[model samples]
Target: MTHPENPSTFDTVLVANRGEIAVRVIRSARAHGYRTVAVYSDADAGAPHVALADDAVRLGPAPAADSYLDVDAVIAAARTGGAQAIHPGYGFLAENARFARAVADAGLVFIGPTPDAIDLMGDKAAAKRRMADAGVPLLPGYQGTDQSDETLLAEADRIGLPLMVKAAAGGGGKGMRLVTDATDLRDALAAARREATSAFGDDTLILERALLHPRHVEIQVLADTHGNVVALGERDCSVQRRHQKVVEEAPSPAIDAVTRAAMQQAAVTAAADIGYVGAGTVEFLLDVERRDGDHQAFAFLEMNTRLQVEHPVTELVTGIDLVEWQLRVARGEALAFGQDDITLDGHAIEVRLYAEDPSNGYLPQTGTVEAWQPPTGAGIRVDAGIAAGQQVTAHYDPMLAKVIAHGRDRDEARRRLADALDRLVCLGVTTNRTFLARVLRHPVFAEGGATTSFLTDHDVTGVDLDPRDVAAVAGWRQLAATADAERRSPGLAGWTNATWLVDSRPLRVGADDRVVSLQATVDGIVVTVDDQRVLVTGTPDALRVEGRPVHLTVHRPGGDRLLVHLPHVDLDVSDPTGLPPGADDAAGAGVLVAPMHGAVTAVAATVGQQVEAGSQVVVMEAMKMEHVIRADVAGTLVEVVDVGDQVGVGAVVARIDPADTDG
Candidate 1:
């Protein structure tokens, strides 16, 4: 039932998400002469999306459960703001079938796939059934309704080893685990079920045969009411960490013309089978086993019945605005261009710039954005949500912005991405900037063999701290020490610090607990490493280390540390450990510590329960991800945090009483 409407009839539309995607949607809506309404949580009251909207409405509080995920609140905001349609900007309630139905019931057009399509694709098990019925390829495994662990383990043993346990209703790689051994099947099932329950509210599990070197390839599909479904080429989302996509690029390097065409056709079939409208993506795991002479196989992963985060890259390459198409399709208008008219012109790559520390197990970083600047140049675009001074709390996704670059070829696109990274700057919070740079610089990445397990195979575990980087760090630290000593004494280098003979202080670099001791002298500076002295000299601003002038990028006050930006790297020198312990661990041993600042969603551990190493102890929800704290060593659980409790970093959540280990 296509509603006949004049082209460009939507005067107002409400963005139904927060952060960068909301801002991105608003900007697109405005570009098409549609007035935009922004809905915000309490934490995002002052976010950039709120400032960019034609009208803004407060939904609820920081927790997504109270705000963005609240269907009634979002619909109310749309109605109060006089929006004719609501555009869910991915994530949150974007793919919620009930929310879509509610929006339609409220007489406001939902600018996405129909509720039927959402329901068909939102559930992984159901979607697989549809795809399988549609003759799409599927990985060999069980996707049944059985919930018993014993049954699942038996099925896994029958299906063979190396399989993935996935949530039947999950997206974004949450509630996913790889089981390679039968002995660990029960634990994997429990953990995956727990994560799936927390993430998607559906604990039902599905098992898929694992591909050793799988590349995550997906095809973008667009559909209209006129039965026009077009597959807009393919994208490679192989670079991932913790099962979450971090980098994506258009036109996969692994697929040939035949494979690409097959993939596109599969996506079109998947979309058409569900009578889908609007934009959607069909994800597949491409198996490349050249070593075993196994031909490449693409299996149906899932269907995201909404616009993807990497849609910008597709838009850039095709010169087609998917958002505009979504609006047009929702308005009952036929697509402006046909498949024959569309051209996949240049290559485009998108990198998600998140407020996270990769070295610290990718923990979300929270702080006020003191400075936020996105790179701007030809073929460079940034969809950013926060501005300088905006607080990036731990209440939402760590993704602060998305940086995309376009070029005539992959090399040119890579170059443009690097150039943009150089101009991009953010202060007052640790981000994945340095790690993104490393990924781009990776040799295999340049050669186009980056798979989903790239990080697992590569040595990115010691990110931001390399041996070569350490030497340069020492050089920069000594230079800063020399300059500080000169400034402390007015007579030397014509400066004053009100102290003489700069004392030796210990400075610890990032992650590594090893300390480098340095002392400031009138003539020069000296760094003692393992009781060996290395002479250094420098000015306060510029230093001549061994007659080579070294420049320090930033001088952090209250210490002898300096931020040094060199030709090859950047380093920060500061005390690794701060503040002395208030009490001995023996005084409070067996006290459960909060993994990080977050709300306790579930406390699985209890008094007198014997737990093994890596056993699930407590579940803390932070930045929308449920982190399960495990016992570091085998012990008897003595205490635990209550469910629904909010705790800060280092706040005790649970503790295990030590038990004798000698058998």
Candidate 2:
């Protein structure tokens, strides 16, 4: 690890990030024979990365601003741990120029681009000017110095309607909004500014024409300190939700060899022209509607000065360890190979599994993971920092893990990824596993025809609970009750007894209620759902329903609730077996509740004030995104919560009484 050009040999590397990316860098650093230090928030003290590192440092509490985003705390940790370099793994302070400069000032290597490079590209406003000057094709929009509201409004009108207002200081879909109507421009600007200030500490924004049904394509570029830069190829990240990427694949199904070469060259030129070093991605938006045969026109989106979340696809196809190279470049090492030496083999696809519910507007979910079973196949890989009993909180990003698959071709890779998603089990919290599997297996995505509008353009509904799932839980509960009562003799396959009380159990699974009648018999426990009876014979883990074997991982988390992990979706069922038959049928949305655990950022309505349907009642911030709680019915506010109040999930934030009758 010694280099004559750079005499400072770094034996210890500190990862200044969290979640899967932190685990990712730590693994690579350890593989290269370097002692690793993991910096974590109080929330991540028991995280996988902390356990994997040679030593660990606590940054602060769970909130990122006081912990991962704190520049001084990170530098102090690097110094205390005797780390020679710090790797900001893709988020938090990854693209922060101040953090990069501080690392250099502290005599430690920042394993990314130089501070100047970060400054040039981290701010989207400045990056657009530079790229445009460099002759990169771009959308016509405003990226000016005057950030006044009047100026922005005039510029926006000039740029025309249906444009995007984005935060200049950050990426990853934060502080971004699309305005289709002229009347929504003010609200969009205000929301974008608020989110940007909270996310990136900069309210400066840039506007761009929102191309209809465009495909997001990005090129991976790696440069060494010795002026050796190479383009590793392109990845299509067209499948998205809320401007964030969901599914990504290498060697895009949309573009051909000729367009690939052109895009690759363009990325190389941009990276080389800016004197970029280390791992970075140059993003582009392909106008699918304006396609001309094999030559689809793509415009420069932005250049992320740090590694991208979807870099795994590039790595799988190119057989390159990106984190290892980031360390090497930071240590002033020259590239061992050049552009001609690089090769792309096969195909790869990756999907991010987040702790979020798909049916309910994709609201973020937070709960302890009772079971986590990642699928393992020939070419499947799981990058995660989660474990059983890990409490996923709402203070950070909702993404829990990433599942990637590699195969000989696109279809093979697609099918492999879909299968892996189906087999992956993450219990306790609601996740997008089922939604992800649906995306991979969707006809458009499988055929490589997905655009940025893929998720919204098509109706990809949330996974429904299977009737067998309801039956399994019911049977298991009955078995447990009978065994505890000691009513019968011990029998086959962990069954201790049989139940005498042959009563019907009411189960509620994700807003749907069903009555399940059970009968304990000599053969096995029988479960009846909606007049249909099925013989369920098995333990809590595996069950044979109606003579067909089904594998399920069940977790009974106290009092009447069971979290069942199936092939696609994890169902959290409310099982009330003993009490009574007539359960209260609660309905109506008279009171507005916090959809998730979060801080009330804004109080949009006042008590006694009238609000129409879809009117904003309260604004809540959680997991780095703002969720506006709106009125579901036309009513007058009877109660309201103040700003800066911390509320838990389902806590009443506001209440609205029905509007007065016309008579």
Candidate 3:
């Protein structure tokens, strides 16, 4: 399907990215008869994408600045790999105009839109102006060149309250803040600038009027050098957490036939207006009145000049390979079909599987994945970067995979996706799999009524840690230790031969630590916690808990950690009976622990400074987001880590001495 009009295009492609997207692009490129090259950092030497590529080149160290974001390093890597085309997957430098230009200067074809299109749309302010000029409906706000703090504040007044202060240069909510009150505008502006500068290296700010309870939807468009453009349906990305999309689907339940057509035409027009080429997405903010209002119901949000993370949903629904289309377009291929030929066949849903705990404000997690088993069934596809023994580091985003499902209808797709998520067994690291299932099956979401405020508006936290799971883990420890002892010395498994000996085991699961009493017997294993005795019988893997057979998978990831998978829950519990409790424990309340591995970006506490309980002591940056570490109890600061200090998860960043009670 490719023509040779573009001299820069070639048979070899260098994927200038990492993680799942890198794996995705490499697979597509190879499948389409192109040689694939992968670039990796020191931390990702054994990554999935690198191993899958026919050739791979090292970029730099773990930090993105020294690795993926380095324009010269990427271009040099392409040159060394002898790749004629470079594919910058989503994130990192995908939307970086300078990176695109650098690829062209290296005589390499960038498998994306031109540098001009990237620059025009990458900057939110400029893209909004351009879209407005194209007669695209847009929300009223400030998108001017003036980025001064005073001027922005003045403009906020004109735009009214509940306006968004966003980093004009990037997406993914890195530098976005919602200001509902006038008093919080200044702080929001400062925070947004700081975050924007850290994430995108661009502190340019733009203000947009915030819509209440809106849905996030975007249109997928492809353009070729042959003056052909086509719209490939739409994707709904309304379910979000912290402004980042957590779930996406195609053939949005909210959009009707009339609205879909209008949105599709508008997106096609937007792409034509910018003279964009290759694959791109035009995002919009859809108000609640989807079908009633014509153009007034929706407004242009921003245009992603690169392949989106949620593109698989659109692909599944449209039965198209967007990556292939991008390659063909870059190689001067004409459109094989037009908009009239495009059609949505079915409903598709995709959930972002992240290495994070949903109960703890979705704090990003990092560790070695001891075992990973992605779900497999009809209409299910998983685009993942993780594997058994793969290390999930703190240097990058915590998203480990994308689990997608498709069916003939929305309900079938929803249930299928939920079931697939439940069956997914990824141990060693905590994830939001259960939360995702809950969101899918929730009444609002099930009825296709979820909006951007779904996460905050719903009670998605009803699932509790089953007592039997704790007991089962305790029984597993006893059985495992007994088996190991018997392996080393026959008939030396337990101290007592007449009766099973009971032992108390300290187990910790997501901030709750309990001492479980259990005994292993020839008949079964008995565990008691909270005065409840639970019986577990059967082999280690196949177990019947409390006389009821339960499906389970367990992995010992060294030390005292045990990853227990039970149905829809995967609990990474640490057996702390032999090891001493760390300083972050409740007994050491004055110690402020780093929740995750990150660099200390700010320090508010100092030695000999008086502080109160719940006061911010330090702020750490990881995965391009800032997390504040606060003191646990009232005390005077005695020890505090300075800025630029790299700390690991559970590392104490600060210590406070209890205030003198004599006073």
Candidate 4:
């Protein structure tokens, strides 16, 4: 079965990336009989990818500029580790033409498109011009090289109201903003430019007329050096928040057979025109309101010159190993099959699991992953980059894993995905697990009507939890802890008149400030929460709460932390006992603390400056995004943290004295 004429190009590959994508690439390279090398920064020295590779090399520090994005460091590591080829997996330099050229100049194969192709499609302005010339429908916008403020402002006026300002060289929704009001144009432009320069080292921008109620669809294309290309199919990526995709599925419910064929043809044409090689995706915005004759009108959005994050959905449906195809095509081999050989077998859906608090405006959270247990079933697949005891810092993206499910039909797939999310458990930090389940089960999504404005249109922040179940789980955990402790020391179980004394403890669950009491009893345990009594009977493995049986999985990672997994809810409970009496529950009430770990980028307040409540005082940058911190109470800023200072969660960045206080 081996092609003797086209021998393999390399025996070893260096994955010049980190996290889940790196682990993904390493698995495929090793399966193809190639040894794999992994590169890591100081922060990822103990990551899963490093441990999975045959050899590992250090790049530099934690900051991407000094490590993952450092061209010299990556090249040196590849050479030092004797890697015959380099695979830039999907992020830092995957679309950088200069990086691809550098790898070729170093006499190593770059397992991606040609440098010329990357350079052609990497710039949004240039890519749009080429697509239009090739007879592809394009949205009206300004991609001209007039970089003056006056020209851009004038162009905005000409382009009409409600336009989008996007970074020409940016991806992953990093440098994009939607502007509706004319008065907010200048500030939006300046902010977009600042973020663009910081993220991609390029401040060039392109403006486009915003499409209302559009469906985001993209077609996957594969090509080889033998002058052959094929379109795999389309993926519906319409569910988004803040312009970033959260849920993706194959075989879009919005398009028909005729539309699918037309989109596929256009994608193939676009790739052929550029002489593209390797795996790429062509994105389009289908305006649901506008129609060209009987069909929907779609305009070319942009072409991702690298593998996309949602590629797994395509792979599951088409029964294709895209990574293997990438390696084979890089070795001058033709595609094993033609477009006619591809067939869709089933429906698949994937949701990104992130370390964020949904109720708190989805702000990124950071901590050690004390416990992690992904769902396991016939149709579920988990692509995770984290493990127990791994520290999730603010230096990288907040995504922890991806949960994907495949089934015979769309409804079957949706139900399976929702069940998998309910069974999943992650502790030591807040996550959007429950929120994702709610979205999948929502009637709007169940009816296959989720558009780009799904999150904006629906309220998915709430989930129903019985207070009785919460109290019962907490009580069971306390009883279990006491039994374990009594086993260790018999005398610790105090006895009065030859009978063991009943014990009671207090617990705090979730974000609620109310404390519940739990008491040990001869039959089982009794819980008092919100002036209501609930009886919990049976053991920790199986419990009967008010005559209803429930299965439980409890984990005490350390200290006062308790993770209890019920049939429907997972609770992270903590017991704050043995502290000094009269401790202030609201310490630092007037002080502004950093909500997450990040570097302070801007400080707008001086120590002696008086400010009103909810005044913006500091701006922090983390994970390539910016967050503004505001004062909670009106007061004079007594102490202010400086810009460029790295702060951790709960660290006081600024202090405010009450306005009524005299100097």
**Best candidate, lDDT-wise?**
3
Cα lDDT for residue 484, candidate 4: 81
Q: Return the TM-score for candidate 3, rounded to 2 decimals.
A: 0.94
lDDT, residue 356, model 2:
88
Which portions of model 2 miss their true places by more than 4 Å?
Answer: 1-8, 291-294, 479-488, 491-502, 520-526, 538-542, 577-589, 659-663
User: How many backbone clashes does every candidate have?
Assistant: 9, 0, 0, 0
Off by over 4 Å in 3: 1-9, 290-296, 479-504, 519-523, 580-590, 604-615, 631-638, 656-663
Each candidate's TM vs. the true structure?
A: 0.87, 0.94, 0.94, 0.93
lDDT (10s digit) by residue, model 1, range 1-663: 122244346589999998888988888889988999999998888888999999999999998889999999999999899887899989999989999899887777888988888888887888898889999988888878877887888888878878899888888778898888878888788878877877678899988888867999999999998999999999999999878898899988888877887788889999888899899999999887632122357889999999999999999999889888887788888887777786789899999988887877887778767666687999999988989789888778889888999999998998889767766777656678767877877899988999988988986634444433443457565555455777787557524566544345455654344556555566665655556565566544655555676543453534444444443344556654453585323323455576567888877767888877777888887886777787877788877888889888778787777786342
Worst 10 residues of 3 by lDDT: 1-10
Overall lDDT per candidate, in order of appearance: 0.79, 0.85, 0.87, 0.84
Candidate 1 overall lDDT versus native: 0.79
Best of the two (1, 3) by lDDT:
3
Error of 2 at 98 (Å): 0.5
User: After superposition on all CA atoms, what RMSD does each candidate show versus the true structure?
Assistant: 4.1, 3.1, 2.8, 3.2
Across 63-158, the per-residue lDDT of candidate 4 in tens digits comes to: 888999999999999999989789898989999999998888788888888888888887888899999999988988999899788999999999
The CA lDDT at 634 in model 1 is 79
Q: Summarize candidate 3's per-residue lDDT along 1-663 as a digit string, tens digits.
A: 122346544999999999999999999999999999999999999999999999999999998889998999998998899888888999988888888887777777888888899999999999999999899999889988888888999999999988999999968978899989999898788878878888988899999999869999899999998778889998999999878999999988888788889999999999998888989999999997644365438999999989999999999988899999888888777889999999898899999999887888788988888889999999999999878889898899999999999999999999999999889998878888898999998999999999998998986854788788888777777777777899899986676647567877678875678988887766688889878999887756666788877777888777877787876678878855655766345435798888888999888868988887877789888887888887778878899999999999888889888876234
Error of 1 at 119 (Å): 0.2
Error of 4 at 393 (Å): 1.1
Query: What are the per-residue Cα lDDT tens digits for candidate 2 across 1-663?
Result: 112235357889999998899999999999999999999999999988899899999999988888999999999999899898889998899998889988888878888888889989988989999988888889999999899989999999999978999999968899999999989999999999998988888999999999878889999999987788898989999988888889999988888777787788879888888999999999999886675456778899999999899999999999999988888787877888887888889999999999988788888999898888899998898999899889899999999999999999999998999989878889888899989999888898877889998888897856656677788777776666656555454444344345444667578876678988877677887788877788888754456787777776777777777787767667778854543665543424667888899988888778888888788989998888899998878888898899889999878888788766231
